[model samples]
Target: MQNGVVMEETKLEPRVGVAVFVLKGKSVLLGRRRSSIGDSTFALPGGHLEFGENFEECGARELEEETGLKMGKAEYLTVTNTVFLEEPKPAHYVTIFLRAVLADPNQVPQNLEPNKCDGWDWYDWDKLPQPLFWPLEKMVRSGFNPFPSQSHPLHSC
Candidate 1:
């Protein structure tokens, strides 16, 4: 519909994501995005995967970038497939989830990216706050546990 020429809608490709489930004292870290796609929703510390970066590297980088906290060795946890078809700019992402503890338990989290995140807090996985980001909601619905050394964690949320 531009210059009397009919144009077809452009398609969007799925983006890859890496999210870290930072566990501390039986609670996981969650942050509320401010002006981004999933505004007002609680999400983990994560971002788009950069080329040539592994999941652990991406998780650590994103955690530091967003919360100013260093992430310890991240363990492969699970994955989520979420499609934001209801968004103004419908998009899809295949997010890889990783579990990590803080490199230093005494180090507190700070809001490094105020424009993106409101703040960070810890919440129990089973008692997560409402209106979670789609990727996380999907993962929680699947009952994927981030706890360590638990039998049947995959079957228990």
Candidate 2:
């Protein structure tokens, strides 16, 4: 309590989040977040990593949960240490970036969680939507690319 006002005592920890890069040709799948944090901003399909889940498992789960599309497999791309200092509830996250291909090229993406996201859309890497989510914006600023390259190792089955 401060100045006779009761304050909730909550533990703050860096949450582990997975962001999947689902590519189709030159476009990548993105969704507009509708939640309190990063509201109305384009971001990759992903969410927090559940307990007892590996990076790949988390990525696959988030991808399928957020967007109605099944990914073949995901490869580790990079990680971002994000810190939100301006939000009402400041938070930190260790965001793991993964790349994957759609199981079916013709499979369309749908908004599975309307409460958290608006809808899914494919955008070219060079022409992404404005107001990107924090992690994704940081990734672009750091020169991170999701395109398939021979330089980076891929994990596929």
Q: How accurate locally, in lDDT, is each candidate?
A: 0.85, 0.87
Worst 10 residues of 1 by lDDT: 148-157
lDDT of 1: 0.85
Please give, for residues 1-157, the per-residue lDDT of candidate 1 as tens digits.
Answer: 9999999979799999998889897899999988547888999999999999988899999999999999865688888788887877788888988888888987788899989988999998779998898778876787767788765332212
Tell me the TM-score of each prediction against the true structure. 0.87, 0.91
lDDT of 2 by residue, 1-157 (tens): 9999999998888999988999988899999898767888999998899999998888888888878798886788888888887777889989988899988889999888999998999999999999999888878898888887777655762
- Tell me, by lDDT, which candidate is best: 2
What local lDDT score does residue 151 receive in model 2, on the 0 to 100 scale? Answer: 78
Per-residue error (Å), model 1, residue 36: 4.1
Could you tell me the TM-score of candidate 2? 0.91
Q: In candidate 2, residue 64 scores what lDDT?
A: 84
